[model samples]
Target: MSTSAQGPTSDESLTPVRWGVLGASNFALTVSLPGMKRGPLTQLAALASRDIGKARDAARSLGIPKAYGSYDELLDDPEIDAVYNPLPNHLHVTWTARAARAGKHVLCEKPIALSAKDAEALVDVQRETGKLIAEAFMIRNHPQWQQARDWVRGGQIGDLVSVQAAFSYFNRDATNIRNKKEVGGGALYDIGCYAVNTSRFLFGREPVRAIALVERDPEFGTDRVTSGLVDYGGAHLTFTCSTQAVAYQRVNALGTRGRLEIEIPFNAPADRPCKVFLDDGSTLNCSSARVTSFPTVDQYHLQSEAFSRAIRTGSPVENSIEVAVDNMRVIDALFRSVESGRWERL
Candidate 1:
């Protein structure tokens, strides 16, 4: 629950978290690292990559102070406060647990673990270690989602009746991990998780049942596309995700009294516009009215800031580890439904 009254704290006095990057993933380079640079709540202290040359290059390119050739060495740095885990899907659990055991707070990449059981284990480790753990689903911290959530709860769209969403991108590169099932690469775990998370966030309720059809390639051994219907209370959510398709992502809501739609809603800037249509057909579109910040803002930065706040001040995070675990449970059930060709209970 974000409060408008909690206006941006003065930067000079806020505690800055020292962050270490565990991998030089594309997402880390393009989004997360830049966001961290822009944030007053964090400092990029170190970066680690298996390849020393790549690690050195990333460190030089990003202007980070230290580069380690091993992830364990980065973890052992006494000055580091937290880690941003951007490893492969299969590695999320093992590395997150190791970070926890090292007494380091973690903001791991989404789908924190491949299975619900593993997700729960990660949460349990967080509890035992008394460290803040957040999955790097930065969209949850973005203003588009925050405003949309407020509208859904405030009845701006009246009674929420249905949701429709899609997220996809072309991924023909066979060498990419997304094409490997053994490593937890697939459309549902990759982009489809966005649709699922967005739908659940807007509804603020868990689905009771799910049905899905997944298309798999024998060579890749992973589902290239997955479509599903999730029943949340009386509401319905229809979603599709694909790695074989061209890029397209959107989340739309149909309500009893009106409709609400967001273009690039999940990954939009904090100042991005969100549109609403009333039952009478009146339309209004405006930027995230809550944030009066200048220029554009990074959701990753905001998320990291919030997580740091949680660590230092004991403030609760918007997306708790419990929430991530529950979400993974829902996703696990969806996968089960696909396997059984039957409705799966969540």
Candidate 2:
């Protein structure tokens, strides 16, 4: 893998991270691959799909250099510096470990692993191999989220008090991977994660407890909708996520002085500016806002850049393994709260 255009850095010896796609999933084609393509510090070296024809098609469509029939073949490629694992949720741990063991950096799709234990084990492997590993939570790297964080931290919204957020999408395709219970399919894993991660990210703190009321489908054994409250220090957050509802993503935060609200909170494109609601009943809208946005502005690229930068700079990121594990810990407790009919202390 030849190096792509490098960013302006003091360390000239550090090469651009040559990137490879591990699956031909919709997200890979529609979101992450495009994000990866836009970054200067990364190169789209290859792509792997179970079907050779599909891989070839994706390679042609995306202008990727190489296409492979098997993931291992892509992993084995000397030119490939990193692999993006957009495989099914259950397959995340296996491929991530395999890629790490093969001496390649990994960027796996979220809920990083099925459990905190698996996430920890994967982190252990990355530590041993001295390779980078990250979960594909695009919001973490988006400019809008960065701005939201700044507003809260800078007292644009004084002394944050409460939060209300929701993300929902109606997809009734039983054949879809998200509807398959055997493969980590559910509203929680598919979209509720946005609500969970968003609340955590925006608040910049850990939840003390979680209370949930889940409306489940008997045939699918998956919750159709989940509404819950998460306590963060002195703050309280209320959220809902669903797979059987009209698509929507919204975040409303109330502070002692004022409140902030966003309509397209997560998965927005990078170049687009996110609208800001300030006190004094005035609106701050950004021309950067684009209808075509989908969470994170070149966020995967930023994510990839951050991982490589950490590799080069030898520092820890906020989205470290321990952080991923903590995210899962909250998830676990939330599910338990749903089942136990009471608030689950986190």
The C-alpha TM-scores of every prediction are 0.91, 0.88
Top candidate when judged by TM-score against the true structure: 1
Error of 2 at 342 (Å): 1.4
Candidate 1 residue pairs that clash: none
The residue-by-residue lDDT of candidate 2 on 1-346, one tens digit each, is: 1111212222335776788888898878987777778666667899999999999999999999899999999989988888888999999999999998998988788888777778889879988987888777877766556666777888876888888989888987888888888898888888777777877787888989988888887778778898888889789988899989998888887888667676677666556545444443343443222222223245666776676666667655547666777888778888898889898887
Task: Indicate the worst ten consecutive residues by lDDT in candidate 2.
Answer: 1-10
Q: Residue 238: error of model 2 in Å?
A: 0.9
| Model 1 regions lying over 4 Å from their true place | 1-12, 269-295
Tens-place lDDT per residue, model 1, 59-140, is 8899999999999999899899999999999999999889878879998998898988999998789889988888888887
Clashes of 2: 11
- Please give the RMSD to the true structure for each candidate, in Å: 4.0, 5.9
Quantify all predictions' global Cα lDDT against the true fold.
Answer: 0.81, 0.77
Question: Among all windows of ten consecutive residues in candidate 1, which has the lowest summed lDDT?
Answer: 1-10
